[model samples]
Target: MGSVAVPSDMPATSSAEPSSGASNSPNSPSAEGSGNAEEEPTATPPSPSDSMAPQGKVTALRLADFKTRWAGGEGWIARTDDSGKSWKSQLEHKHIVNQLFALNNLEVWATLDIGDSKQLKLLHSVDGGAKWAEIGYVPNYSFLHFVSSEEGFSGNAHTKDGGKTWSKLPQPAVIAGDAYFHDRNNGWAVTQNKDKNTLDIVRTTDGGKTWTTVLKRTTAASVTGTVIRSAGKKDAWVELIGDSGMSQTSYSLFHTMDGGKSWIPVLANNQAGSGPAPGYKTGQESKVPSNTGSSPGALYVVNPKVAFMGGQCMACDLPNTMGKTTDGGKTWINLSSKFPGYGTQLIAAADAEHLWWINTDNAEPSIIYTSTDGGEHWKVTHTFDKPQPTTE
Candidate 1:
């Protein structure tokens, strides 16, 4: 596997409260579901936190599209209503979902797949996802995310919509991977053009009035995937894939705390991709070489001490891939085996003890798993895509 592009985040990036319009159904909390990503009028909500609860309290889980074959996972969104007791799916667009976000419990935005024509699909469900409406269907873009319901943006081909709908930004800052926003004033996105030798990172404040591209760092020197994000305006990180394919080297992963201003390496190897691809694990001993200073393996920080790193145990196997994070990508550790299959389907920390991992395995629906003890154990909380038809 040459490299992998993965998107990792703790949760909501804005301070706005989610909207509440829809009520929960008597669906009987099926152990398998995707958490509601908004504060709908239907249930109570959890207190705001800088980071998500690491125990993976995802009350619900669902696929991007059940009508089509898997693989075109446009994006996802989550919200905890009723004090994390249940979740609701907020998107019902006919096209693919690119990015799902909650400006607040009531205010939510999801960028769906707008075809190459001017018939784009920009969905907004004021009723907590039970139903969606095409707020505005503009073309000339395929991917986008919002800093808030009042302001949002995305990037894609300019063939449709005459490129008029999307305000052209400086430089050809086309991105291919993940994007993030600290708030309504600042946001960023990464590009994997390869030939460009740069990771297109863009930020906008004062709503979407303008955009500035940070092309200082390029992906040419990285074998891992790149994502532009900030846990908060004061703290941000540019996480990359920890190599898991060929080398058992722990420091195959890397990240930057200064919002892509600097770069650092970690002994992290992600368990993504296939055939020559690597896999990821969790635990303390399996984290890295157990050295000091910069010799760390992989690091991901939700907050100062509220973090985790890659590690391993006495009877552990490299599995060619795993991840660990310290306070600030410092002390590394390893993850658990609850994450079955590979290829960076999804990675999240709902809280300190709850971690969520969704692997991309077309072979089965058991792609979503969760860890309540930080990464010690995992449970197949849900399965997606439904089993396919077989020959008699």
Candidate 2:
């Protein structure tokens, strides 16, 4: 009852289209809806460089139906009780598994990369993974939130005790994107201002030292990415990726009950302000169907109104679906076209009807879909094996 933090693919900030002086009005200024200071506050735009680079691949998390845990290719880490048929490894490092976490089943965590070298590290496992240790070195594309087993967070660094020790988080996160806390003092993030290109949705009660900017956006679109999901205390769900020119690639889902202060636009392009959240309405927004290529793909929320999303663009060859929004997100449904082609790379929801999907799009036997009626129905709960390929 404490393992949920697996929405990868962050690093977004691009928007140079909606202009004519811009003001698509979701609150306009491009988009803004923070506490309000009577508008007008734009100037600090720069110092925003990009490139976090993790993207190793393959990630998984499933709490029951036999338990589960997985990391990516090279760095490895595995587990499966029966639901996935079989698996065991638990740890084998060199550099790959960019992110993975499982705060419950005995606690587990991972982050190890090598691509750009920056040489990252931070791996731990209480027991569910059998064994794993190396708990230090982080920050290269940081985005981890531990919650227990010693407290955590790795980006702005702050460890209560676990990762051996660490500290320094005075407000400045967005090592590219992605961050969710819900415990050590609430949280929410999706930042990137790179000098006004815009993309913000920040909040922090006290844990992050400071931050406040309920929502803001103006990335126009060229190629963007972001993913966030939350459940209890004020709900949360954000999945954005733009770039709707010719090559397509569009997606924008936003929801935040009260936690982030304000934001509602279930799936948008411009629903004005969209509806539902304390209260909001205009058109009702629902437009996520562009070329579908950029890839931000995957969301899991299971509280303030169920959730489960999917993704795949494989360069826009398309043919990948899985969406289910009980009512909170306003609307959504397309539970994978009756199980066809399998795509949704990762999702885990142990409640609100139970769910668990992980289809590595064929990275050596990966499919493991399962559902308990929240996704309308799903099957195919068996298949595993994916780490074991290191030749270097």
Candidate 3:
């Protein structure tokens, strides 16, 4: 009995049921509803290392260049065309791949979690990661976005006949948290309002049906998650997160060129309604190393100018910062003395100089950091191993 740690800002458990004519306009907020689709879980029995090859805990990744990639967690779905050096486990089962979508290495999709029974399933893969196919049953979607192989989006539900079939997006823009879609209808979300202490930044364009709450931040402390990123159509970026008392977590950085209407507070770690975001320089006068406090752990834009922000305080191991902005972000510089201070977890990109820094903070080994010359020289390519526990 050891599992009580839910505070990344809590707000995800919707039974959804708001389709048919969908609408929401008193400032839009209604589209998350759907519940009546869960009948695909009868085929268990393949856990004792399935045949040994795929490890666990990588949780969900989808690179596709710098040498192909794709990773899922615990129950495996691995792939690596040789950047992680070698890996190719394509589908071992025990169920625990929270979310993964690779729209190009030959179409793919995922969202499994059906072991300890929190229930969820939605897998697809058109031949890239070998084969996998269960295409329905999904709802605790805190976030998941696919652009094709039918169509997808699930901060609440939407499938155009790929994930079997699912719908409910005529309003509930997002009630739980996190979402990012730059195609199938344009998107961006970081929701959690209705007393969850405030953290909205919604915007959709007929894709998720409807939504438009441009911006809203209500913090005094006690906001825990929010991350939205975009790089094309007018640029976008966000990172709210709060609650910096002891467990540490404080962040702020909002920017929208013209998309979300308006926003620009490029980094307001002192959090309190935000200040300094006019064009450049805040904190250590734009040097970007406040002795490790604001929690910049990851963000990689790569467009509209250039971007990459970092911090990795694995519980205060500190000294793992990395910042850079070309102009769109106004100003930033500190490259963390050229890298490696540990604890990055995840950060990916394919432009503005390629990158893929991940450091699982030791889930058994996990470590990988690469950069094409953007973060200014970084290398350590791959190192992952430590995922073997399926019992059966």
The candidate that achieves the highest TM-score relative to the unseen native structure: 1
Candidate 1 steric clashes:
77
Supply the TM-score for candidate 2. Answer: 0.31
Question: lDDT by residue for model 3 over 1-392, one digit each (tens)?
Answer: 01111111111111122122322344433212211111212233345644433654576676645567677777677776644545667788876677675656666778888853534788887788687878677665555555555666565466777778776554453453456655456667766655655566777776667778888765444446666666554457866665554444556677787887777566655522343221222343543323233455766665656767776454444335566666766665656433333433566665555566655643355555555555454545555666565469
Q: What lDDT, from 0 to 1, does candidate 1 have?
A: 0.39
Cα error of candidate 3 at position 192, Å? 27
Residue 383, candidate 1: Cα error in Å is: 3.0
Candidate 2: where are CA atoms >4 Å away? Answer: 1-83, 89-130, 133-162, 172-237, 240-321, 324-335, 338-367, 370-379, 383-392
lDDT of 1 at 347: 44
For residues 7-80, write the lDDT of model 2, one tens digit per residue: 22210111112112222344422111111111223323223342111223355453522244454555566665
Query: Superposing all C-alpha atoms, what RMSD in Å does each candidate have to the true structure?
Result: 12.2, 20.5, 19.7
Cα displacement (angstroms), candidate 1, residue 351, comes to: 2.5
The lowest-lDDT stretch of 10 consecutive residues in candidate 2 is 10-19
Collision pairs in model 2: 14-219, 15-219, 15-220, 45-195, 46-195, 313-316
